[model samples]
Target: MSAAPPTVFGIARLGKRTKDLTKRLQPGDIAIIDHEDIDRVAAEALIERHPAAVLNVSASTSGRYPNAGPRILVDAGILLVDGLGDEVFEGVRDGQTLEVAGGEVLLEGDVIAHGTDQDDVTIAASLEIARAGLSEQLELFAENTMEYMLRERDLLLDGIGAPEVRTVLDGRPALIVVRGYHYKEDLATLRPFLRENRPIIIGVDGGADAVLEAGFRPDMIIGDMDSVSDRALRSGAELVVHAYRDGRAPGAERLEELGLGDEVVLFPASGTSEDIAMLLADEKGASVIVAVGTHGTLEEFLDKGRAGMSSTFLTRLRIGSKLVDAKGVSRLYRQRISTFQLVLLALAGFAALAVALWATPGGQALVQILGARLDALLSWFTLLFSPRATGS
Candidate 1:
């Protein structure tokens, strides 16, 4: 006879890439990821998946930087187990039912691995330590930036090798969305900008889905096509596949399989999908580039967990003042109807209404009636107080 199974916390879903793993996650599932220092973007994706718990093979923070991902996970009421090590992966496969209790991972009532069960208190304290060690990280980041500039000086100094996209961006503002840092809130905040400007919308990977969710169709979709949905790909937007500098595009394989081989343009460049999207917009003569959910600060850049982010830093330098992030979107877009403008609009509306009323016989009669009523009220006031409106 088989032994009784231990208390089941959730069903386990395992994968090395947190982004890919999130695609398979359902509510009440336990996500097993190998992501190190999980960035804000990944955490947000995981939170949306509604996982009951997350068991990581690597340290979620590693004191590398004050990454907000771990804190985001804990705050969302999801259980987190840190640094379970590669041994956990050896035994665990995808879709295995497991129990997580008191920092111990149990498979069929047998303890297979142990880890640190992280909560808000633990994550907050680690973030403080990560902030203290940020100086070293900044120095390293500077070095990487210089090194990247040397490698891609042409792309940075001059707009070289940007793809010839079919979308007309000339003199029009471009809004690039990424599935990064507070994207939902940022998108919501840009509703005024959306209604007023009607900027060319560009989505990076899953951001296309986000754009659709926010009630806008992307004018262009740029990414490796891994995380994007087939529905987004078929949404009549121009697709730009990001390729490596060596001209290798693994994402192209998926596109071909979906019978969309002729529907894409390959943009071979280094850096991230977001970086390439900005470059394409800039080269296409966009009046300005507005970014949503992309990394902004030094900490967010490092939290992306790759050396290629140096290209994003340099991409900003390349795009220069034309690039605007979501935090500054409201400031740049104070183009909203000002008090003076509102007064002018109100006056124009009243003038139009008055002209229409005077042009109609019924309206003219109504206006004459109102005028007579006004004169009667004035005469009554004058009679009631003789020389003044009051007895005084």
Candidate 2:
């Protein structure tokens, strides 16, 4: 007798990128993606959507580095099928009902694609291999950094074609927020600085939402506008849509459809949104740039599953002196009590002292003396009212 076949059922939603697909994904839907080396952020997003299962056409963990995406999905009890290949996409259409059983993708009782089902053992083994490849990734990162310096040398050395926006950043601090690792915690930590300095707030995509969540509005929002919420777009922040070097602006189209295109600014560049944001601030004459939740280290960039970080490296080189990470700022910034705060403190101290004196022995003696005086006055009134004393 043949063994029974395993079966998992859900509607399939397909996309070449995890981020793009997640926007349309609904609960209990199966996500079909071609994402290679899934990042932690992408995994978190998919988990948030509560998908039934994830089917990847490409390798979820390619042994490039110890990526946590697959582990995250599997640990969350979401079934993950790896290396199903591009054929899976052709076999399954968007919103088509499909069945997955024992690493086989089935379309109406037919096996469309065969893949390896990932579990704890396999994922852990892959992570070990990825850890071994970290050195190679580091070398490649260095090479890419050198190449970026050559390609973007002109822009880095000389501010060429930097867009001029209405937001004045000259000689002031600019807070650039990215919704990357620990952004909420970092934002909370910097609340004091935000209150005191009131730096120009620049939110990169979803970071706009973070700013709004932290009880503040962004002064400028710069990004592709895909991940950002509609609420953030209509936040009255000066919108700067990042365009490609060829002047293709997809974000602009989204803005126009939402009736917000009239006031939007188009900035055509060749770097990531966060990079552009830093350059925008630096070019606008900002004295200092404090970055919150921005990727700074090699591992951080790797976690995003980037082959290279050329633009980020060059952007940092250009604005090295002015740019500082949130951690550094939080550590170095010292809070000083203002004169008004000191005066308030003194007043509070006096009020506390008055309450303490009112509870003391001397305070009770003073009350008794006042009571005796009131009694004598009352006795005098009674005597005056008597018939003998009045000649009634």
TM-score, one value per model: 0.77, 0.73
Candidate 2, run of 10 with poorest lDDT: 327-336
Q: Write the per-residue lDDT of candidate 2 for residues 12-120, one digit (tens) a residue.
A: 9998978779989999999999998988778988998999889999999998888889999999989899999999988788989989888999899989999988888
Q: Kindly give the number of clashing pairs for every candidate.
A: 0, 0
In terms of TM-score, the best-performing candidate is: 1
List per-prediction Cα lDDT, in the order shown. Answer: 0.86, 0.87
- Per-model RMSD to reference: 10.4, 9.0
* Error in Å for residue 13 of model 1: 2.5
Estimate the lDDT of model 2.
Answer: 0.87
Using lDDT as the measure, the top candidate is 2
Number of clashing pairs, model 1? 0
Whole-model lDDT, model 1: 0.86
